[model samples]
Target: METVNVAELVERLGSDEDAVRKMAVFKLQGNIGDPSFADIFIAEGGLVRLRYLTLHASGNTLAYSLTSFSRLLDVDKGWECVDQELVERIVELIVTHPLVNILRGAMSILVSIVSHPYTGNRTSQINNFGFRALKPAIAIYPQFLEMLVSRLSSADHALCANALQLINSLMRDSITHDPEAEWPKFIQKLQDLGVIRAVYVLMQDSALQDLAHPLLEFQSLTKVLLRKWRDIPVNQEKPEHRRALKGIYLASNPEKNPDEATENGDDTRRSRRHHPEKWRRLGFETESPAGEFYEVGFLGMMDLADYVRSHGDEFQNMLLEHSTKPSRQRCPIARASLAVTSILYEHFEVEKSDMDDTKTYLISESRAGFDKLFQPLLLHWTRLHVAGLQAFFRLWKATAAEEEDLDKLIELVRILIESVVGGAARIKDVQDVEEELADFEYHRLRGLQMELLELTYEDAWGQHLRQVREELHHEALQFVKEQRIRSLLQGSWFALDSHSRSEPGPVQKSTATYQYAQLSHNRRYLHFGQFDLMGDRPPELDTLPEKISNVSVNPDHSSTATLKTAPRQPTTKITIHGYAPSTATGHGKGHSHARSGSRTTQKEVVLLTLRPSSHSIASEWLDGLLMLLNQQPITAETSKLIDLVSNYGLKIRLLNVRFDDATFAGEAPQVPARDGLDEDYYYDVFGGA
Candidate 1:
């Protein structure tokens, strides 16, 4: 490789020739990682040149220039060459950039510039190399956040996509560095800017397919926001009150920050005790019973109500429009609405003072939003059963059961049952990974159903709600069972577990502490990655088929045996090579009996022996494996370790639940399929087969 001169590249940044400027940036990116080169670049005022180029350059030239700046951000001293003004300019450029690549590059640079290096509440890391230089750049954090949130209203898909990605990157990195402790203020700033509203608006964009970035980030961000208010215990003593008051005083009066307040004199300390009640009245006593009354859910509900008061009609119209479209073409605005309403309703608690204005406001707004957003789904219930049910369940959970809300809900349930019986049900097997994630309705519905089953409502209308739930539960069970059978027929593996082999032979057993399982796509095979103790880098060990035979359940069968224990009596065992008793031979002292010379031997292999954390999880894996193996021959070509099944005795204890602990019950009752999940929905929408 030819080395380029730094001085020459810096001068070429202002070149009229686009190619020359682009080449200069490309060369500068190479030197950014070298401290000596970084020193030379800064000394020669490289940052000034890059900033100038960023504003003037177009296309690839601009992208490369931003890339060079981004790489420079890795150097501690490199940040000193830039300032908050420059950071703000980068954010502005991100929003104004017409090209997606340029916008992405600008965001990439900003993420590096503002990346927090400290984890948790520890402020000691502020002396670290990057942190010192980042002191000034840190001032632009809120500005960058605000710009990203504002861009969601953009018409350009590319711009919106990059904005979402950058925002997610910033948030995810911030949380990793200092989650709930240091990032709450930033989250509050976002909430004040109507982030939830922006999220809903962006979700309705039909052209945007990369929604996971924003959706997951927003969910995570919302949790962090709600936590600050939710975790404050209600009511506390004077000492606790004093501490909260001091903290609040410092926060509100920045000049009297803790350090300054302590430095000022003993009088500051004396004053804190004197005015504890002052801050308490201002809602500082988070742990006090009186403080506990400040439920964040109520606040969230009020915010949402206010939103509905202003945009309720727009939301209703959007819902109506999308409900009329086919599943594939339909934008998933319903989910966005559900996310907002559910969050509001989830925290909404009924107070004895029903006549209180705040209480009345919540009820009226929630009822209005619920009726508008939810009623359409019922009208279109046959085609959108799962999503409709999920939305209905969540809203119902949040309801205070005022006369109007309850009456509407009862009527909606009646309509849902009538719709289900009208024969609008449809189910499609996910053919590929993309189709599997095409919609989250099925997964959401499954979660909602589980939640409903666990909830015990004591209200007068609870019986009616339970009746509807029971019917839905029965249907869900049946649908899940059918899907599993269909998946097995197609050789789909729902999940997989990983473990280390202590001794590989006929007497196989899995023994290791750090066991983490991952979900397998298409269910064709389970690839057990090499077990690593530190969990830094894991390599693949083997890929086994999704087949099993002779599975055993908890001795109690009523409970679950975790993978952590060595069953004193051998709990939850499976036989890979069950055979005629004549051919059965003992492998070792503690090992299960294996078939010797196979005389009518079942070829299915016991690939792993897992003791899941819960009985439900164990049964889930057992049934999923058995269903996949049903009526299918275990041939050598079907699995790599087919021949070793009897000899290797693959035994792995299930250590933990993978795939977000969302398990599909083996014998679930049939329910209507969530329409948008299947590929056929898309094919029909696009006018295909």
Candidate 2:
């Protein structure tokens, strides 16, 4: 208990008698919780003794030693005392130790260590701390993953939570840090090891109702993986790529390859340009390729509907179960279940038979499941509310051909519109309603209503729905305008200032500085100024364009632009050629002060160029500027820009593109792959060679 006795207690750790050694470890575990005691113990070489005990001790002694280390790791700079050798010993115990307490203790220590704040690449950090021990441990020792998966079923809530957290943390750190190199291997390993299945099974455990955060996190991370994995390219030699190539070859040489053509004659053929339309009809985005579809499979199957069907009862119960009071814990599981159900209903081949018996059954079950959440979601909006609405729309669309289901679908649509509009009206703040309308959920809701109007144009309910749709559409446009203004007003941009006289010189020949550029609150004047340590100075160039001509993105011309920083990303340049009033010349950090009574005006072209840190940021700026200009009649170029912005926004939101500044220092930005068939696979998929 005393600081003076800490040394004596640590010295007993090496006693010849097992009882004395165990007693010393037990005492150290209790005392190590105190920072001063931990400092004293480390000063007494207590960590070396603890490390030795972890490797050689057994039963309660090993558990006590791990507990002591866990306590020590809790203190400031305690992780600094841990070395790779000690981490290996702890990992060894994790894989081989039979005692539950020892395993729990070791897991806790590793979690504390891995989660310690660090700079630089996460992979480098893991390697430095010997956290890579688990990688090989799982690779060589088959039972390690199984052991972790088994613990997910443990009745001990802490153990269950820790096991889930440990696995999630490892996968996230490794895959996110080096997604291209690590993602496929790590995800495949998790799938092969049944880790994914274990998480699903854990969700079914009614006893561990309190483990919601970890459960929700694991499910969300899995969703991200599924989305990201679709973008990653598989080997060009894979059967999917080979088959696509052979089809193209046969289509081109139908006379010479008559046998091959006849073998595939039943297939409906389309040109490469028409592939996008075909995929869209199959319920895929135009951006997604047929090969990419084949790349996304769970548990080695292309379709997850079968798995959902197998777990149909459990999922139904998860969604349908309700508590008298709203349960925060229930919301996540319910949302996760809804997300899984959506996977089945959201995307399906339109040409396929309308509703097979299997689909009919799942729809019936999922509809009942959704019924329980509709009222609760309306009362209190959780993410489940969004998923519920989206899933219900997909369900409504699925039954489009069934005359018997038409009335029921219309009734549900009316109820949904009443609930949403009623909820919007309750929030008296006009801005709050606009904010709600801006969200993806409201967007989906509005879209569904519009679709319903098309299906029931002559129906009496159609008139009310059309009015609601128009109101929502108006609110959404207002929200977009507001967002553009807010974004323009809030942030300072890094603009490229080239000294070269030529137009848009290489970025290397230019310098970048923080520039305060924004449109006036009244939207009358465009303001520009330089930012200094103190704050923004007066405008250097304040001019509203007489004829705003062009806003576009061009590739960076800097030779030093590497994949780590730029990666073929473009920069946004706004070429505003217009006249300016004499007032545009003002006293500022970078411009001369105007003389009193100087009212001269001149016609001049002002070019503003922005070097965004990433493609998403560039797209954001371009979108804002284009919306601000609102050029007359919306040129074709401007329409294309709008479409580009929409696609980029969806991908950015899906990837949740928030990265630490340090993460971009020397690594490729781990974003989803670019749209279309991968350029790398061009030859393999369609080349004449």
Candidate 3:
């Protein structure tokens, strides 16, 4: 390789020939990282020359000059070579540059300077050069924010993307490094500048999707701005916004006039400029990098779960309308939006007025919004995109928080169950999907897999996802059991007779309504209709079983209160109370009807007067209730027997019906041999015993 002369390149950077200037700038760009080169560049007036070319040169020379300056400022000692004058010059060139490459070059330098660390090197440590340059550079934050926002409307996509990234870097620095007192005011100023609205507009640009860096940065910045201002009331007084380009001339050009002093007009201004050390104290160095960046658009309108929580119907309509575009549906943006939307809908709170009809909420507007939100998620299950699947699990987490009401929760759980089942089965089908994908698309999917693997099953979130699924399955099983119990208890029955110690009251000739009956099967619980019973609506009933004691039936017969004993007919007078000792009604060895063994005694009071039907029907119900209490099977025969017993004036006492399967067991009886068969009838023929 030929020997290169730093002196010659420095001189050539000022050449009348464009080729010489371009060559010099490019060679200088290669040497900004070398401490020796940075030293010589600073000593040989390289910063002054580069600023000259950036502001005065044109075409390739200007682009090359800006690139050289950006590279120089990107290093530790190199930051010292430039100052506020050069920073203002670079901003000026970016704002005024006609060529796209020149604009990109200048904006890159600004971003490099803005995101430059306070602790990246020793020189920055010694003289605080990074802050010296940054103090004034940051003053341009408001200006650059507006510049990028306006450029977002540019017809040239590459320029718009570059502008967006520079804007993001600038805003990130301000929030992360600026005075804590200044944060709210800065954020409010940004909001007033329409930063949020501009990002949304840029997101809609079809041309920018392929530009991953700027597109992603725009999303990240939007999220930060949102979370910062999320709690700030919109109607509050606006912060006293600093003017755009407010501090462009805070420090005079050291290159143009090395003796120029910083202005000190007001006492406050003197205190601020005299204390550049105070600027360094602003904790910019400690800002940790923002958390893992999700590629899927979680910052979009679709990502705002708060919006959906407060304004669901309107947002649902917007999402549906947005999804109809073929371009939007095919892009990665739409997939992210849909994934998040589905999750938000799962845990969506029904309004207080709407809670009475939760099922209707799930099936609203002919089910169009529900289908739109979830159909794509189910369809794409085979793809195994981690973000989408994580969103699915997140939805489960939110739903489980309020899954206590078995009936209400099951409605949503069934949808999730179907999705999980279908997704588990869909893995085999994904192999047929073409393995080939475009570079951007492939990187997107790979990013998703990395994020998912980071939350391997042993981690809290992974364990939580598994927990939610298990919980849903458990709830579903309980729901099914309750339904079965409900189906058994709901039916018509005849009450033939009722006897009480007290005189019977007049009975109304109406059918009995037995919608709920508490039972003590395994553990105790009150049973109500799981599904609607025989009415326009299911009756609401308490789910905890209640006990009653000393219950006696009082029945009124229109024709006769008691029958004549002449024909061996029994009298209708019956006394059901005190038939069994109090201890016998408690948790005895054979008392299967009792609940809560802790209770010393639980006398179940069967209120027979609630039955308006005949005595035969009333007794059938009593048999049913007893069967439920003892956890015994009550079939059609049991009902018939109870009815027949009631007609004969003999009530079947379920308390005495104890199951003793051991006593019922017996060996088969020995068979007696037939006389002719045991005889020698075959012995004479075959001699075969």
Strongest candidate by lDDT: 2
Candidates 2 and 3 compared by lDDT, better number: 2
Error of 3 at 83 (Å): 1.7
Ranking by TM-score: 2, 3, 1
Q: How accurate is candidate 1 locally (lDDT)?
A: 0.44
- Candidate 3, residues 306-373, lDDT tens digits: the string is 33344445333433343344321212222233344334233321011222333453445333422222
Q: Name the regions of candidate 2 deviating beyond 4 angstroms.
A: 1-4, 76-84, 117-126, 204-210, 226-689
Could you tell me the lDDT of residue 403 within candidate 3? 20
**Best model per TM-score:** 2
Which wins on TM-score, candidate 1 or candidate 2?
2
Please, what is the whole-model Cα lDDT of each candidate in the order they appear? Answer: 0.44, 0.49, 0.44
TM-scores of the candidates in the order shown: 0.33, 0.41, 0.35
Candidate 2 vs 3: which has more TM-score: 2
Model 2, 337-442: lDDT tens digits are: 2233333222322122322333343345453332221121121222323333444444443444233453454344343434443454322333343344334253
In model 2, which residue pairs have backbone atoms overlapping below 3 Å?
A: none
Q: Which 10 consecutive positions of candidate 1 have the poorest summed lDDT? A: 650-659
Model 3 stretches astray by more than 4 angstroms: 1-3, 16-19, 30-45, 55-59, 122-144, 153-158, 201-210, 221-689
Alpha-carbon runs more than 4 Å astray in model 1: 1-11, 14-19, 26-63, 74-77, 92-102, 118-147, 155-158, 165-189, 192-194, 201-211, 235-689
